[model samples]
Structures are given as C-alpha cells and as structure tokens.
Target: MAELYSKARTKWACRRGMLELDILLEPFVDEAYDQLSEQDKLVFQRLLEVEDPDLFAWFMGHEACPYPELDAMVKFVLDRVRA
Candidate 1:
C-alpha cells in the first residue's frame, strides 16, 4: 500500500546511526507524524536533514538547535514522547 511505503520511507530516514536517536525518532514517526500539522511535518523532515551528531545533541538536550523551525519540531517530538 502507498501508505505503508510512505511510512517505510519515514522509518528509513528516522534511522539515524545512534541507537538513542533511533529510539527517540522511530516511535515518534510511527505514532505522531500523522497527527502533525503540514508545517510541523515539514519541520520534522528538515530536522532529519541535520547531521546525526547534531540531532543527538539537540534531542539529548546538550544544546538547543539553532534553527527555530527545527527546534520546534524537536520539541514537538520530545513532548510527544514524554506525554
């Protein structure tokens, strides 16, 4: 199904090398993406364009991401996980 393929693509993209990143991203992609606004979805994909080390730092709270859109998306994902 087309829907499954879309999810597969998202899953593959979410597979950042770090296990910690994977753990945070995978479930969020599966469970929360569909509920996101179009702007938020774009923000999430933009977040994926970031390097793995940067993602690790941002997602782990070592530092805030420099991009406002990316930071908001990261926060959205983190909030979904915490909730």
Candidate 2:
C-alpha cells in the first residue's frame, strides 16, 4: 500500500491535472493504517475528516502538535513524501 501510494503521488505530480489532498495523502495515510491500533485508527480517521487551522500548525511541526491527532498524521505523511 505504501508503494502504491508512492506511485500515486509520483503519477499525480508528473501528470497534468487537478489533484486532491486525499490523493496526496493516500500513500502515507496507509503506512500506519493497520498499525495504528483500533483506538488510534479512530483518532486518525477523525483527524482525516478535519481541515482546521490546527492542521496547519501540526503540518509545520509548530506548537508541538496536539495529542493523538493530525500532527502525527501530517508527520507520517511528510515522512513518506520526503523519502
């Protein structure tokens, strides 16, 4: 799934068309998918459902990120991309 997501990101970046956040997150999102434990997965799911200002802070690694929330998810997502 990680490899698939990597491929998807590559395709999206190399191709010329509209791209969505969900598509960009597809790869890393699944990295910790099953590994997140049930409770964490639920938290992650809710995190995915949100796009609040808090997300921006977390994405930038600012404010130390809130608990088991989008900050961690963004870090995971960025790690995959940076890899």
Taken over the whole model, the C-alpha lDDT of each candidate is 0.84, 0.52
TM-score of each: 0.88, 0.45
Q: What's model 2's lDDT at 63?
A: 62
lDDT of 1 by residue, 15-83 (tens): 988999999999998899888776677677778889999999999999989998898888889999878
lDDT of 1: 0.84
Predicted structure 1, TM vs. truth: 0.88
Q: Model 2: per-residue lDDT, tens digit, 18-58?
A: 23454445554545454555655555555555554455456
Candidate 1 — worst ten consecutive residues by lDDT sum? 1-10
Best by TM-score: 1
Q: What TM-score would candidate 2 get against the native? A: 0.45
lDDT of 1 at 3: 45
RMSD of 2: 7.6
Off by over 4 Å in 1: 1-5
- RMSD in angstroms between candidate 1 and the native structure over all alpha carbons: 2.9
What stretches of model 2 exceed 4 Å from their correct place? 1-20, 52-68
